[model samples]
Target: MIKIETPLTIDKVKCLKAGDEVLITGTMYTLRDAGHMRVIEQINKDEKLPFDMKNSIIYYVGPSPAKLGAVIGSAGPTTSYRMDEFTPALLELGLKGMIGKGARNKEVIQSMVKNTAVYFGAVGGAAALLASCIKSSEIIAYEDLGPEALRKLYVEDFPVIVVIDSLGKNIYEIEKEKYKIVE
Candidate 1:
């Protein structure tokens, strides 16, 4: 497995390819649909985002309320397709990577290639296991959105698969083709 660090640089992302297994370490931001909308609004108003976008990664999740003495609750990836509407905009702002489950739309995939970005697939239904990788997390913006708020997270050895690479190559497409039953 390739070990990657946060604030991923263009060179680093370029080296990654679809179908590689990777472990990401360092900080990543969290945003659900509400937070995503806010990002677009912030950009339209020329307002600075809650976190710097350059070379940053965002994880799509709305973690459950933490239990006492826990840093986070069951934290799993949300479906990536839901974020497709705002993904191109985020990528244009130098967002280097994203972590979520499922396939993205064509426009979003094209944007990744144009922006030298990558998309990672976190295993679905692995919430409790994945939550352990989060060392710390805090609300960074849109707290009123509750679980849909934007958050800053410090993670270590977070496991993910390269679903889409900077070249617009896609693991989803490859796997689908491989499994196709030729009649």
Candidate 2:
């Protein structure tokens, strides 16, 4: 497995390839659908964002409330497609990477290529394991959204796979082709 850290620069993003396992260590933002919408709204209104987008990675998760003594709970990745419509705009604004589960749409892939970004896939069934990697979590914005509120997370060795590389190589498409049944 490859080891990577954030804030991810174009150099770091370009070095990754689809299908490579990675253990990421550093800061990442957590936001679900409602938080994404709120961010877009802020951008449209020309308001400053709560965090810097440049060279940053956002994780798509709405973690469950922590049971006393835990940093976060059940922090599994959410389906990425739900955020596809908002992704290109964020990519345009220098967002460099995203961690989630499932395939993204064509437009999202195209945007990643255009902006030199990457998409990582976190295992879906390993919520507790993922939460263990989070060293700290602080709500950053949209607190009214509760679990969907934006959070800044400090992580260490958070596991993921490069689902889509900056050059547009996609593991989902590659794997499908690799195992396709001959007609």
Candidate 3:
């Protein structure tokens, strides 16, 4: 499994092909619909953004509340397409990676390819399993938005499968055709 560090570049991510498993280290921020909207609003106003988008990876998630003694709640990836509206703009600002579930829209895919970014898929129903990989968690911005608030998470060997590559190769597309058993 490849281990990636933050401030990751398009060059570093571009060479990765689909079906590659990776362990992402360093800082990653979590955001979903609400957080994405706020970020977009800030961007539209030309106002300062909460966090630096350069060479960053944004995870699409709204985790469950953490129980006592836990670093975070049941943190798992949410469906990706909901954030598609805001993703392209963020990608333009140097955001190089995204982690989530399900397929992304054509626009997002196009943006990824044009920008040489990458998309990864984390298992949907594996919250506890995923949470085990997060080493630490802390709110970075938009704390008022509850779990949807942006937060920096420290991950160690956080596992993921490259679903879409910079070259526009998609494992899902190939797998779907493979499973289509034509008569």
Candidate 4:
């Protein structure tokens, strides 16, 4: 498995390819649809964001309440396409990587290619296992949104796969072709 860290640089992003297993380390943010909407609204208003966007990774998640003595709980990836409408704008703002499940839309893929970014796929049913990778977590913004609040996470060796690479090569497409039954 390839090991990577944030904030991801352009060179690092470009070097990755679809279908590569990766263990991501360092910092990332957690945000679901509500958080995403708030961020885009702030951008539209020309207000400063709570966190820096450059080279940053955002995981599409709304973590469960922590269990006793745990940093986070059941932090599974949410379906990514829910945030697709706001993705391109975030990519344009220099967001380098995203972590979630499933395919992105055409516009988001185009934006990723243009912005030198990547998309990671986290296993959907592996929430508890994924939470163990998170070393620390803190609510950074939108606390009123509760579980949907934006969070700053310090992770170590968090597991993911390069579902879509910077060049727009998609693991979903490749795997579909590879496993397709001949008619």
- TM-score for each predicted model, relative to the true structure: 0.97, 0.97, 0.96, 0.98
lDDT of 2: 0.96
On residues 36-103, what C-alpha lDDT tens digit does candidate 2 reach at each position?
Answer: 99999999999999999999999999999999998998999999999999999999999999999998
Q: Give the higher-lDDT candidate: 2 or 4.
A: 2
lDDT of each: 0.94, 0.96, 0.90, 0.95
Tens-place lDDT digits, model 3, residues 79-112? 9999998899998999998999899889998998
For model 4, residues 20-135, the per-residue Cα lDDT tens digits are: 99999999999999999999999999999999999999999999999899899899999999999999999999999999999899999999999999999999989999999999
lDDT, ranked from best to worst: 2, 4, 1, 3
Clashes of 3: 0
RMSD of 1: 0.9
Q: Could you give candidate 1's per-residue lDDT for residues 1-183 as a string of tens digits?
A: 999998799999999999999999999999978899999999999998899999999999999999999999989999989889999999999999999999899999999999999999999889999999999999989999989988899999999999999999989889999999998
- Count of clashes, each model: 0, 0, 0, 0
Q: What TM-score, to 2 decimals, does candidate 1 have? A: 0.97
Kindly report which residue pairs in candidate 4 clash with one another: none
